[model samples]
Target: MAYKAHKLLEGYEKANSDNLPEVNIIALAHFIAKDSNFISPEISNIKAMRNGRESYGESAIGYVQLKREGHITTVISCVAPEHKVTSNGYKVEIVVDSSKGEITSCKCYSCIAALGGCKHQLALLGWMHRRFEDKTPTEKACYWKKSKLSNVGKTIKFILVKDLGSKSKEKRKNMCKKKNKLSSEIIQKRKPKRKIYKVKSKINVRKDPDGVSFLQEVIAHMDCKLKKGNVKVIPELAKIFLPVDKFDSIDIHSLMKDELCDEVAKSTSNQTDNPLWRRLRYLRITASNLYAVAHCNTVNGSLVDILHGAKLRETSAMARGTRLESQVLQIVSKKQKMIFERCGLLTCPEHPIFGASPDGINENFTVEIKCPTNYKSYFNFIDSSGKIKPQCKAQVQLQMHLSGRKKSLFCVASPEFENNRKVKILPVDYDENYIRAVMVKAEQFWKNTIGKFVLE
Candidate 1:
């Protein structure tokens, strides 16, 4: 039946027909994953040839046969149009055998005897390759009219593409199930219930000033000497310094420092009037910089800023958050019977340069208060179980690691949302690995950078 249709096109477009290289089905399938360039003469040529062919007129032939793992067969009538033929053009057959890594049959009238191939045969191969390779479910269904079945042929020329779309839906459903199973395994491994406590605290630690005078005070205090020619490393004062080991010193100031910002900057890179590139180029990591070290790759900029004595800019957001933190502590203290001790920044005795300024602490648990300006930010700190988010988890864990407390309670107090202002205690456990990695960087920064600069 396939060869019978090819016979009709033997004399059609006879002048243009010539010997062409054979379409190797094996090489074509391999290229499908890495390239989509097989549609060489452009889609417009295919549509134009289909429309111009007077013999095939408006009749359509659609055959799609899909096999599991090793085989695929596609048969299409008028797969290659011959100019002004007496009957319907040729039918093309493409058969791919994965086991043999070859296309067993690639037949079309133009170059059937040549074994190599013709443009019509190649076009059919491209269509079949695309159909088997595309794995996205159909976004919308293709509708055809029953009364005008033959007329619908023009629009529904590539039936294999639509068939693959429907097939892909089944493939995707199975994939999603496998993904869920893997995710379940991961969650089970990390499943430790969080402990909660409704402790009341009235203590409020005010936000310290960030100015030249404060910097002078911190440096002067570090100048305090012991009798044995040893310098006192005050953990309380260490919070004011930027820990260098927290962030990449080289890439920190580059144009692509922030991934989100990098994407935005790239789209606007061609704009001559944009000042973003210029501004970003000169931006420096400073002591007064307020950023999330727990959520990002690097530590805060305080260490770098202090070493170079960069000018500090006071931010209203930091001041507001700090003030709100104190207010939250006050409410917690009043509601609960427990008292939270007011404290300064505490550093590890071994790594004095690494400091943690926990909002409040008691004998049983340490406190880390968050005052999110918005509801989204507020909810980001806690999950459905009131456990801290993984990003914020590191922060509280570090606080516990430094304060010598096993349990750390994180409280979110958002004043803008009346229902969210209450201090909900979400106790986080200590992460020794995280603290150890941070301490190593802190040690390196202190000994190599800060030690040399300060000692000199």
Candidate 2:
């Protein structure tokens, strides 16, 4: 039974390209693997080709083999020079269909970016192209020899340019070192010369005045300006420069509250296009990101950078949610028979740096709406069994806390469902423990990571 199965598998295996004529193999390799920027002029592709050419010229390619099945051919090779200690380098494979006149796939087993095509595969391809370019139609040069790298620490102490191979005896003869009198003269002339200069050190004899003297001078100047009725000198400027008896005596909480209120008033519209809204949200750790901030494990990861005003490009799902939010809210309001009033950002009084901008708020509860882009997400929301996603739960809890409400309605909407089943409303009660834990993490993150960017 094992022999029969082996025979069947052998019948299905692709034929080795070694059986094909040398001319045909060379033609196929050249057609698929020739280096040119005409097909793809991207910088990344050009860079890969440049590195691959260097690898090919360095004789890094080893143990190349080809397999053919109908019109498709696959070239496989080992690239051995990339690693200093390991003899078995990355396995690179390139698949090409001559009938299509294009490479179907290229992969490097040891490369992280193998899915996107890597340099090792390109090195094998360039090696094939060099073989085709170097050999004539009538000459059948064998490509089965081991790579130069395979002889490292054995048979050869080191590899040199002269050892790679010489096409002509004259070229080999001219490879010997020759003396250049002109180069030696140029090097001698370019040598650096030492120079010495006299230096003297000086010290100031005068003593600097203290802070009180500078403050008295500033106060006297300001008083003189005020007495002259100089309208250019504003009273607010005097207040800023004036020295106070104690810094702790200032009402920082009231000042922060007033500043936050002013910002909220400026960004009351809360629309995405509003510049003030974007700017205000850009500075604060908004409720939507609370879950990520709470759960992040690294101090300087991408999440911290994002919170520090790094702009994230909008995805299709975000665009869809933004476009369908108003319609979903209308549907929920109509179905629930309650008016949901749209409100601007609500900042926490105690933690002024944290804020939440809920979808809508009423006398009893705040509302947060979600529009899932697909049926799977829609169904997941509908069949959640009184459990909410951690991120969504965190957002709603923060919204409820900021709005001073005890309950929030988590609504999910999808237009693809039937009209009767288009919206799913789940009532989420405010959880004090969860919100407290989240706030602790958020505070630590803000102090350790985001405070420098925001406060400075």
Candidate 3:
């Protein structure tokens, strides 16, 4: 199974490109086993040992230490329970294969399962599992509270101005004499020395790569539509990191477009004919893809599409639909006395991998405008009851989640509509359960697939 995301630790556990230790078998096992809900089948062996009276009470395991050495985990128990073989309590050391979740060795004298796990090792495992499951929500909250107080105590120690009480006058005078003597010795060593000679050195500096030259080459090689086969990249490097089998099929120009679009958005220049602006106006997800996100099993397809790295090229029909949406939004805003502001790319605050870019938004609601290209497209998006069809539900739900809004308004608009009656507005509420389901698929796609490659 791929790694599962923890919502509580989302912000704290960021990906480290330099050292991705989380994906290592041992580290991944430790993280999963720490969660209270994790249940391994090997735990049943511990229960069988307990039923046969092969171990002591649950409290026998004490001062346990767990350390990961390479792919193996070494567990040491400082205090162990006494058994029939020996009177005095024995110390135990258990070696575990973290990847396989099996005990490879034990140091206890009474153990018989040399090829397998013995009672002492199993008992320690049960103890650790129970310890995590035993913690209640209140206990966890109190633990954090005490941790904060302990930090505060350490921080406040430096502000103390005086001791609780004074000692004798002779003792104070002796302490002052020792402090003055130490201060004079320190001052003697702190004197500065004059330089006798100086040597000069010349340093070489390197200039950074300029993007304008690269952009010119890309533009010259690009197709007439400016979609794919525009830029060249190192295939072997991409293959070692990316999940795709064919690097040549992956559109490298799309990444350049993303960077250029970001530069255009952040720049203060007011020029309307910027090349980036011309490309950005036509690059957006199509209505057909939006429907798939809401109604179809297209998560895998979506991930593959992202890996392909193709830029969006708008056709004449797509341009007509975009213009229709804009015209309808303008007419609606004036008639209803409502304002709609354009939205930028938004990522979920808690889960950054999942992202959305809605059409527009207001204070109370998220706005998702869809302009159907034809009658078939319009009917496909509308249910029999004249409501916003279920096919586009997922898009608005994601929009609300990314925008942090409570509700969303899904609007279907076209230039042919004369009044509000021809247009449809459907209200969609936020659904956390649905969002979680989608995030699970997204997490697997990111961690197991995209995470395999290192971006340069």
Clash count, one per candidate: 13, 0, 1
Over the stretch 1-456, how does candidate 3's per-residue lDDT look in tens digits?
421111112222221121111122332245335533232436544443452231342434444444556667565553233332222333456566633444455455444542243455545444444433342234321111111112222443331223211234686789999899779757854876334211111001111122222122223222233335433433432433345445445443334344443343333122222443223322122222333433344434653343323334453345665666656666556755789776555433244234455666777777777776445356656776777565477678777876678888787864346334355677788987976676555454544433332232
Best by TM-score: 2
For 244-293, candidate 2 gives per-residue lDDT tens digits of 24343333233234454535733564556654455455436788889888
Question: Which parts of model 2 have CA positions greater than 4 angstroms off?
Answer: 1-251, 258-267, 378-386, 415-421, 454-456
Q: Ten consecutive residues with minimal summed lDDT in candidate 1?
A: 198-207
Per-residue lDDT of model 1, residues 238-284, tens digit only: 32234433532322112111333323334333322333322221112
lDDT of each: 0.44, 0.59, 0.45
The root-mean-square deviation over C-alpha atoms between each candidate and the true structure, in angstroms, is 24.1, 19.5, 26.1
Better of 1 and 2 by TM-score: 2
How accurate locally is residue 431 in candidate 2, as Cα lDDT from 0 to 100?
93
**All candidates' TM-scores?**
0.35, 0.46, 0.36
* Model 2 residue pairs with clashes: none
Which candidate do you rate higher for TM-score, 2 or 3? 2
1 against 2, candidate with superior lDDT: 2
- As for TM-score, the candidate ahead, 1 or 3, is 3
Model 3 residue 416 CA deviation (Å) reads 2.2
